[model samples]
Target: MGTALGTRSASAVIGVEQSLPSDVVVDISGALTNLVADVFALYLKTKNFHWHMSGPHFRDYHLLLDEQADQVFAMVDAVAERCRKIGGQTIRSVGEVARRQRLKDSDVQELSPGAMLSELRADNVRLREFMLHAHALCERHEDVASASALENWIDEAEKRIWFLFECSRN
Candidate 1:
């Protein structure tokens, strides 16, 4: 990501280098929007879990939720940085998050511990799906590096979501 360091060659895809194609630029815009949706989902779910969770595992769950919130906040930067790198506009509002998010929303106040896990797992699944779709989009545009990154993220999301969902079942 260093501007002065190892630069990948610009392809037909936009923003990879100077004179990026218009369609690629637009595609980057859409990707950024969806990524912000991801950020919103991550933040909301973390807060929900941190507040609502209860059980014999309460302390563990609480700490994990806090950790997740921090990690997710950090990722918000990565996603936003990707948008900036691609010369696309980043999402600026909860309204924009709602508009662009593929993830489902839930009412935080209404949620119980079990419900929090359920909704968070659902969002992670949604994110996994989005990453897969993004990977396919990159494939069509012949953007192998971007496709690879998306595929990696999709796998990680699926694995984490599965763990959270299974914990809820027990």
Candidate 2:
């Protein structure tokens, strides 16, 4: 098969190149890769909170973090796959994720339950912002499938933010 871009895979007898413009693919893939890194970082942070939760509300908080972490993790594969579908590469290692992630790392050895919730809520909000930008890029490129996927991700991130906000409220 011939790629829409007329580029042939070096190792494949028959392979198709991406149909999207190179610049659009680069932009979308870069955005998605950054989103993947942020999602992975957030997943680890949520899991850390889930494991270290301590307080009268420990059980509830732990369960919430676990659920939220699972949701964040679920986005990783989809984002990477989307990059691949566009004939772009994604983060291949933890170091790459670290380099690309925009979310700041939590350096405190201990964080209060409220602090954990607040931090996660903020990060989710940031992730939603990135998703919105990526969605716009997809729209500009007429990539409806990727745009639809981003819409779903944006909904998920918004729900997480709402839940975290509610949980943090006194």
lDDT to native, each model: 0.68, 0.86
Q: Return the number of clashes found in candidate 1.
A: 0
Candidate 1 has an lDDT of 0.68
lDDT of 2 at 88: 81
User: Top model by lDDT, which number?
Assistant: 2
Instruction: List, residue by residue over 15-94, the lDDT tens digit for candidate 2.
Output: 03246766667888898999999999999888988888899999999999999999999999998998888778899999
- Residue runs of model 2 more than 4 Å from their true location after superposition: 1-18
Give TM-scores for every candidate, taking all chains together and pairing residue i with residue i: 0.78, 0.88
Regions of model 1 farther than 4 Å from truth:
1-19, 108-110
* Weakest 10 consecutive residues of candidate 2 by summed lDDT: 8-17
Worst 10 residues of 1 by lDDT: 1-10
For model 1 the local lDDT of residue 50 reads 85
lDDT of 1 by residue, 64-154 (tens): 6776677567667666766666666788888888787766556646656677777777777777777777777766755555666567667
